[model samples]
Target: MTIQVDENEQEPWTVLRISGELDLVTSPLIRRRVHAAVAGGRHDVVLDLSAVRFCDSSGVGVLVAARRLMRSCGGRLRLILPARGAEDGAHVNRVLAALGVRRLFEVYEDVPAALDERTAPLSA
Candidate 1:
């Protein structure tokens, strides 16, 4: 399946809400979007992956790259990977955790929390 990335702004954050499968075929799209955001001088980014149904190694790579890019530019990157329901189980979250890179990012359960500067990230 394909991926969908919707861009929005919430004050200091540029939120990118992503949905659909995140695999080799679609990882580049995400990477481009993140790069575009940074190139536009919008450093603080929020990637809402709560709606992502499937993810593979390439997807994880994109996430890690995004984190690295944001850091290199002195920006912050946050993720929204809600614990959705029991069945869904936050697919991207599980993928990141399994890869041992989940803790490398500041993750939030929702967009509001991700956009809130005063809120803390969820424990990895």
Candidate 2:
């Protein structure tokens, strides 16, 4: 399956809602988009992966890279991984957890929480 990334602005955050399968073939698209957002001076990023159905190692790599990029620029990176059903980004959560990198990201249940400065990330 293919991947789709839709960009939106939520004040201090650039929200990228990604859906579909994230594998070796489609991971580069996400990487480029994150880089573009950073290059455009948008540091605070929120990756809404709640709609993603599948994730592979390459996709996880891109996420880690994005995290690094944000940190390098003194920016914040948040991930939206709703704890709803299995298909709603749970796969990515599982993948990240299995890889022992879930704690490396700040995760939220939704966009509002991710955007809220007073809110705390979900425990890894």
Number of the top candidate by TM-score?
A: 2
lDDT of 1 by residue, 48-67 (tens): 99888899999899999999
lDDT of 2 by residue, 31-76 (tens): 9999999999999999999989999999999999999999999999
Which runs of model 2 end up more than 4 angstroms from their true locations?
84-87
Clashing pairs in 1: none
- TM-score for each candidate, following the candidate numbering: 0.94, 0.95
Give the candidate number with the greatest lDDT.
Answer: 2
Off-target runs (Cα >4 Å) in candidate 1 are: none
* lDDT for model 2: 0.93
Count clashes in each candidate, considering only residues at least 3 apart in sequence or on different chains.
Answer: 0, 0
